[model samples]
Target: MKIQLLVLFLSTVISAFKITDGTLKSSKQELGFFESDSLRLNSTEENLSVSFKIKSNTKPNQIFVKLTNENGIESSFKPTTKKSGESYISKLSLPFTKLPTLFQASSKLFVSLVIASEEDKYFETVGSIENTPYLISKSTYKPTEKFQAKPEIHHIFNEAPQTVDPSIAVVFSFLSIMTFFTLIVSWGFNGALNFGNFKFDLSHFAFIALIIGYEVTFFFYYLGDSIFTTIGRVAILTGPTVWFGSRLLNYLGELRVAGQR
Candidate 1:
């Protein structure tokens, strides 16, 4: 007996509630609620139609449909049923000519359904499914403009390359020969006298200074715009400059020893 009663109670609960369905269609899909479009506004009267379907097991005493804006202003419509049963179709028309103040601003619109019975009241909120319509006195956007391009330019020749300079190459070749001759002289003098004193002189300092200046200037020019360029130029220049500078120092030592003798 209790199982039968439970089944009957569950059936009655399910039968009491209803599901509402909504679909949006319009003469113009891209039309903004507040923007002027191909759809002609009758200053005398403007109408918007919303159609919906309601499915319920039991009959409702009153059905109320309302449209609300973003500002919470509501426009109410009481639908009169044309057909019997749970399915329904209704039209709502808003007259702008009668209430010009309502159309003054761009506003969002929402649709809600309210059903009332002797024992229960059911409320369902529907729409706002469309984009907020813009209200404009005039269209302000124009369609003609071109875009511009800016490119970065680098001066390649004005800045030294990441390789050794030809002028420095000649200087380095002279320095290498001078070093070999000086080493030969030092070995000869030490073998004969059994004692040798080698000293670096002013000419050696001048050679080193010139190489240093060249290196510094080369790096500064290479780094004109990029750090990677500076590092590469420095590495290339430093190797040759050190090799030649050491050779120039040894040659100066040989010169000083000959002068002392």
Candidate 2:
């Protein structure tokens, strides 16, 4: 009787791990997507790879892969399966050049995998391992070492100016012109022609001096060598000067108008 019991226990253990029943299997845990760029020109023509696995008795009938951005633009890859007995591998070749135009710095790409026809469908996200909520880089392409640097001109000024708001521009232009004319009338050209006994004060002289200094610094900052560094230094020194000068001039003009009345 004891021998029979031992035999039964062994049989149960063996059946628990029996491969023929397809119970000892692995499910598709996750997917991986990667890219290779040959030219490395920051263009989209790189090679991409997507990998996934299945560990159940059921085989996936179809798989779909897609790349999308925050703007809802999408690119799809249709995979062809190659079977080696019970194991299957599906692959798709995608060109980066064909990616959506909306894919930009602020955009994201989603790589989703679907195992169609499975009673319990499996889904997984595959892409950059950075764990960022957004996909900022391409994963389906490899970068090549061709070393095509972006033109300096493009970085400097190639980007289109943001669409101007006509109303805002018109308002600002009118204000700037009005302020300029008011300053000229209040101070007079070189303070030589005064409308009344209102002589120019030290504050008025200081305001004019600072404004001239700011304009000179701004011009030099733009036209000088090491423009970025020069601009940084000039802005720090001149920004407050210009702000104070403008405010003082406006305040004095207001006082003059009040006195006139």
- lDDT scores for all predictions? 0.53, 0.50
lDDT of 1: 0.53
Cα RMSD of all models vs. native, in order, equals 18.3, 25.8
Question: How accurate locally is residue 77 in candidate 1, as Cα lDDT from 0 to 100?
Answer: 73
- Clash count for candidate 1 is 2
Question: Which 10-residue window in model 2 sums to the lowest lDDT?
Answer: 17-26
Write candidate 1's Cα lDDT for 1-261 as tens digits: 345323322322312444434443343432322232323332233444545554654556877766554555565677664444755544444444332244334244455656667765655454442323443232233434567655779766675558888899999999999999999899887786343443456555666676776677666876674776766766766766677678776775766787944
TM-scores for all candidates: the values are: 0.34, 0.32
Candidate 2 residue lDDT tens string, 1-261? 445323322322211111111110112122324222111223333444554444444556656665544444455676775554565566655444455434434233545455555354544334421112233354343434686876666346577778789999999999999998888787775785655645566666666777676677767766764777766766775766777677776776887898852
**Model 1 TM-score, 2 decimals:** 0.34
Looking at candidate 2, what is the lDDT of residue 152?
A: 69
